[model samples]
Target chain A: MDQFTLNLLFVGASFALYIGIAVWARAGSTAEFYAAGRGVHPVTNGMATAADWMSAASFISMAGLIAFTGFDNSSFLMGWTGGYVLLALLLAPYLRKFGKFTVSEFIGDRFYSPTARLVAVICLLVASITYVIGQMQGVGIAFGRFLEVDAFWGLLIGACVVFAYAVFGGMKGVTYTQVAQYCVLITAYTIPAIFISLQLTGTPIPALGLFSEYTPGGEPSGVYLLTKLDQIVTDLGFASYTEAHRDNLNMVLFTLSLMIGTAGLPHVIMRFFTVPRVSDARWSAGWTLVFIALLYLTAPAVGAMARLNISEMMWPNGTEGAAVSVETIETDPRYNWMLTWQKTGLLDWEDKNGDGLIQYYNDGSEALAARAAENGWEGNELTNFNRDILVLANPEIANLPGWVIGLVAAGGLAAALSTAAGLLLAISSAVSHDLVKGAIAPGISEKGELLAARISMAAAIVVAVILGLNPPGFAAQTVALAFGLAAASIFPALMMGIFSKRVNNVGAVSGMMAGLLFTLIYIFLHKGWFFIPGTNSFADTVDGSLLGIQSTAIGAIGALLNFAVAFGVSSMTAETPQEIKDLVESVRTPRGAGAAAADH
Target chain B: MDQANQTPAVDKEGRTYWKANIRLIAWSLAIWALVSFGFGILLRPLLKGIEIGGTDLGFWFAQQGSILVFLALIFFYAWRMNKLDRFYGVDEE
Candidate 1:
């Protein structure tokens, strides 16, 4: 079969498997719907959590970002993974011990205030909805590319199928499907990396291969892979691949924000609630990292190798040789992948100087200016090579088998769909369980709540799909907003609710509001108020950023402000109730957490 | 019912367990910060001489070492805390 047909077969088979499992594990009760009946094994839940956590950005965009930016972007890897430490150490076990259905419920009961729960629900909704829209857009793009359909039609079909599984099978179905997705995505990701690694370094493991000798023509070279990569990139007038170029303070703050945001994301935290015991929650966080690390460790290798491959392809005779002629690009079988991607308008090239050769270099570099003038080159000729296409086009670029290509297509879809389902589940429970059952209809029956949960789940998917179709210009900026809000608002409130008894309702409410607003206004000031074009008071650049902290890195400062405001407000206010103190003491232990209980 | 009769004693044990847990957390977080933020960023230049794979040890920690350590610390905390819980007669039935 051809590549398109093979892609269809792989994606179709994976969908069939997921839908079948969803039907088999259809949720029967409110407990199963929300927490998978709290019977999930720690390891199994960890695999599912890994799938839920690694979204389209992790699978598709992250490797490319790392490849282009080099050491400066290691923040993405470290920040995203280190949050599990915070989750496992500070939050997961206690939340599991609290025996609550929703994160908002824990806040409400812990603070003994309905307003606290409402605020948490609002934060969860904003962060999760922004996050889910990104996932939905990812699903549409993946489907449109692999299936050769209009993106709108692809999104509609993908959304409906996800809704069937998520609304019907609930958390139980999503968990098992996500486990399967983890297997698919990991396998698809690693097979290509292993092949490329062996080809590039004569090593089977990509992570080890990254640190091993570069093997050109399958023979070991004395130079290390990273060392060779650094030479080639720097020779092209780009920064060294192995050296840090980002500002130290901003890099640290950005990594910290992502760490806290990863811990704070409602979809990820809800995964811990599915495990059977408090200790299992702790172990589950570790397992989640192990699974996530499998891809993360391999990603840098994939990135560096892809960069090397692109450079070699462009400079077939070496970087010092004459550029590859436009004739060779038109007729060469090796350039077929670029042609295929060009049809999608994501990859393009132009010989601006009419020199009949395409030169790929850092045209802006002063060091390259003399070389360009000597060669009569006008500017860099290979234009519009979008970084997002790197991971998806990697197997093709490396001349891997067509089956590997098909599997990657399926893997990208799985990553997007699984994360979308997880986010929709988070939104659904927040609305039906926290908003409606907790406040609007406290006397709701179990069956009625179950019905409400399914309805809200369907509604969430609809909203995500609609927003995804007409995604605003700021769809990308909103992701930073989501992380900032979660890092600033939700994480601090949750931590204080468990760790401090003195933080009364007034204190927690004010802290969340302060953190949320401060982060929002800072981001808006830089990225345009509410992301409207040309309305920003300051440019979204290092020079224009407040106190030299970028909007993306401001979440850490926002979190610090949250801790400060909460402590300050609490000290000045009335003391926490004695009952609330006892509640904190109770949640700290793991003795009585047999079943997840509804607060009502 | 039996636990209700031993309230004061259980309360004392709970406080000790919490204090022990906090100590463990403090130690783990210190290592966590040291690896990702300290060695990987601020102190990276100081360790430039200790090279691995043609790059400094700091780059290795930034990419791989810190993640491995995070995994180890979590498992260690879980095992140690479970033991602590059982020792304190707080393990779930």
Candidate 2:
């Protein structure tokens, strides 16, 4: 069968499975819709949360980022995963014990002010909506490449699919579908990795293969995999693959930002509320990491191996020899992945100096540029190698079978749809449960609230699609900004609400506004106002950064500002009320947390 | 109903339980920071001599080792706290 037909079969089957699960598990009540009726097993909730947490950014872009940038990008690996530890230890169980329908609900109740809850709702919406834009764009990219449709049409179709399940199933539907998605995505991710690992290092486990010796031709038998990769890239005038190139201070702050952001994200936190007990919330976090680690552990291996393969293929006779001819790239089956990707205009090459050979090396090096000038090579021929294409093109790059490629397509879609659904749920719940029911219309009926939730979800999808059409950055970068926003605004407020009893409503609101505004302004100033491109006052380079900290790493500093402001304000103002103090004490204990309140 | 009636005793027990939980969290977070930020980034230079897979031990810790440790820490915290909850008479029936 042809590759496109196979992709259609696999993606169609996975969508059928998700829609089937949504129909079967349609939510019946407000509890069912918001919290999955608070009856999900710890392990099951863990699986669903894993699917929700690992978005298209993780599946499509992370390994590719690591592949090209090498050791400097390891911060992404550590930062994204390390945040779960904070979530499990500091946030998850306690939030579950609070037994609220939405994260903002806890903020509102704990602070004894609707204004505090409203602030939380705005923060949640901004972070989640920003986060969902990446997913929407990812869906478009995946569909555009595989199904051969325009990206806008692909986004429209994806939005309709998300609406069908999310509007009807709510959290209850999303949870089960996510469980299925986890299986599909993990399988899709691991199979190609295993094949590539075996081909490169004779090891089935990609993680261990990363450290193993490369003995492909049996001559020079014990060259370590990373050692060989570093040697190969450096030989081509690129930086050593295993050595860090970024400033240590920025790396540390970046990792810290991602950790705090992960803990603060409303979608991931909401997953914990579905579990049966507070202990289960803790255990569920562990399980979620276990599932997530299956991909995280393999990611570095995939990055290293893919880099090695691309380098070796480009320079079959070593970097000193003649480059691969353009004729071979056009006609050879091994190079066909470029043809499919080039159609999307993401991968391209130009024979700038009319050289029939393609040179894939670091043209930024002055010595190499001088050599290229002597050789009549204009510049790097591979002009637009989109980093996001690395994972999607991995199986094809490795020349794996058609079925594996099909599985990857399905996996990519699962990743985007699962996260999109989870974020949409967070956005809609904030609208109906926190905004309308909690504050605006306290006397709203159950049916009215449900309708409002559905309408809000639909509206959120439309807005996300519109924003997705013009994403300010790559999927992972945009997602990282979402994390920064969450870390600065929401995490501190949630932590203070639980950890400190002295924080008052005035303090909480002020801290959230300060953190959110500080982070947003920094990001917009560097990335453009509202990320409109070329509207930014400052560049994102090291010279343009404040104190050499990029906007992505500024969240940790923003979070500190939030804490200091909240503490300072609270110290100068009135103390927390006795009733709210009692509520905080109740949330701290795990004894009576199982029977979650159906309505506030 | 019986536990609700014994509010004063339970409140005392809850205070003890809460204190114990805070102590546990402090220890866990300290270790978390030590492994990820300390060994992975800040102290990476000091561990340059200790190499794994053509990379330093700190690099391995940054990319892979910290995640494994985080998984263990979360599970260990859960198990230890669940036991503590029962010991302090705060476990859900």
Candidate 3:
């Protein structure tokens, strides 16, 4: 079959599978809708959580980030996976035992204040909505490229599907669908890696292939893949592949921020509640990471190998040889993906000097710029190479089979839709469980609340789809904004509540305000207060940073301030009651692990 | 509002449990910080010449390798902590 037909078929099959599963696992009660009846096996829960956790960014953007930026971007990996450690060890098991429906519920109850819960609800909404924007944009781009539709129309189609899937299915529906998605995405992801690895290293497993030697025809394997990649990239004026240039201290802190932030995300934490028992929670977390690691380990190999292939393709004669002539672009079938992508307007090239040759270079680099002008170059020709294109473009570079290419398109959609479902579940639950039942009514029938949950779910999907159509920024870019908000608000409060029993309502609230205010002001100074560009006075560059810390790393500092102030203020206030201390004591134990802890 | 339903653990006999919990958290967090942020970033320079499978040790830690180690660490903590929980008569009954 033609590649286009295959793309359509693969995507159609995946969606069909998702809807089929959603129908099979349809929610039968309020309990089933919200927590899948709290009967999910540990391994099954882990698989679903993995799907929920690794969204479009993980599948589409992470390897691409490493591919382009080289070593400076390793923080994305460490920060992302490390957060699960915090979640499993510090948060998940305990929260599962607490058995609440929403994260803010825990906060409100622990701090003994509706106001605290309200603040938490706000934080959860801000982070979840902001996070969804990334997935929405991801759906649009993936749809536009694979289906040959306009980006906006593509986003609309993606939005409608997510709305249908998320609204009809709920968490019970979502849990099973995500399991299918996890299988599709992982299979799609690893297949490409394995193919490329076998061709390069003669190894079948991409994870093992990464550490193996590489043979380029007559060339020996001692020109190890990374070493060759580093030489090629640096030869082209980009940084070395294996060595990073980001500030060491800040990189460490930034990765820490991502890790801590991941643990604090309300949506991810809530996944643990789907499983039964504390030991189950513990084992489930381990299983989730195992699935996630499959992609994480292969990503670097895929990234490094793709970079080498593209560079080699760009310079057919070698790194020191002449650039590929523009004639080849139109004539060579290997360059078809680039030509096809160019029509999207997101990928473009200008001849600049009309030399009939396109040059891709870091024109901003002084050394390259000076040399380029001597060769009568006006400027680099390739423009608008959107970061999202790398993963999509990978198969084209390696010249993979049509079915494999089709799988990638489906995998991207799966990643985006699975996450959208999970987040919508979080939003709906917070609205009905936290806002309606806890704060508004104080008394509600299970049936009535189930209706409310479904209503809120429909409402949330409508809002998210509308926002997705005219999202504030790029998909991957907007995701960082979500992480920033998460780091600022939820992370601090959650950490303080767990680790410091002295953090009373007054202290926790104050710390949240301080952290939120500071992070917001800093982000606004760079990203615009509301993320509109040019409204901000300060630059977002390294020179513009406060204390030389990157904006992403600021959350860690915000968290510190939260802890210090919360502990500081709590000391002056009355200590928690003896009973409250005992509550803390009980949450610490793994015994009585099967029954939900009731708050008195 | 939340304190109403807490499973009350008798603390007078088990205050040492709190100390032990704190110690474990401190140690786990330290290793977590060290592997992820330390070997992954700040001390990467110290590992500049050291390489594994064509990449720097630090680069490996940051991207592909450290995460696997982290998984092991958490499970180990859970296993060992389960032992600790039983030692203090705190294991889930």
Candidate whose lDDT is highest: 2
Predicted structure 2, TM vs. truth: 0.95
Q: Which ten residues in a row have the lowest lDDT in candidate 3 chain A?
A: A591-600
Candidate number achieving the greatest DockQ relative to the actual structure: 2
Over the stretch A1-600, how does candidate 3's per-residue lDDT look in tens digits? 788899999999998898777766774444455556267787778888888888887888778778888788788788888888888888887777666656787788778789889888877877788788788778777888887766777778877878777766553344777789899999989998888888777788987777778866534667677777878887777777787787777776677678778888987787776577777787788888888988888888888888888778777887666777788988899988878777655577777877777777777777676768777777767766777777777887888988899999999888988888778877877777777887888698878788898888777666666666655455655676677677778877876776667888888887777777777677667666555656776766677865677666777777777777778888888887765566556666666655453331
Model 2 chain A is weakest, by summed lDDT over 10 consecutive residues, at A28-37
The lDDT values for all models are 0.83, 0.85, 0.76
Q: lDDT by residue for model 1 over B1-93, one digit each (tens)?
A: 012322342367788988999999999999999999999899999999998987989998998888888889999999999999899877775
What RMSD, rounded to one decimal, does every model reach? 2.9, 2.3, 2.9
Tens-digit lDDT track for model 2 on A1-600? 899999999999998887777666773443366556267788888888888899999999899989998888888888888899889988998888887666887888889898998999999998988898888878877877887665667778878877875765553344777789999999999999999988888889999999888856444467799989998898778888888788887888888899999999987887787688888888999999999999999999999999998888788788888887889899999999988988766788877777788888888887687778788877788788878878999999999999999999999988987788777877887899888987899899999998898889988888888878778778888888899999999999999998999999999999999999999999888888777878988888778865678888888988999999999999999988887777777777787776566564
| Model 3 / residue B49 / CA error / Å | 2.8
- Candidate 2: deviation at residue A446, Å? 5.7
DockQ of each: 0.56, 0.57, 0.56
lDDT of 3: 0.76
> After superposing candidate 1, which stretches have Cα over 4 Å from the reference?
A27-31, A149-174, A440-481, B1-10
RMSD of 2: 2.3
Scored against the true structure, residue A3 in model 2 reaches a CA lDDT of 97
Compute the interface RMSD for each candidate structure. 3.2, 3.0, 3.1
Model 3 backbone overlap count: 8
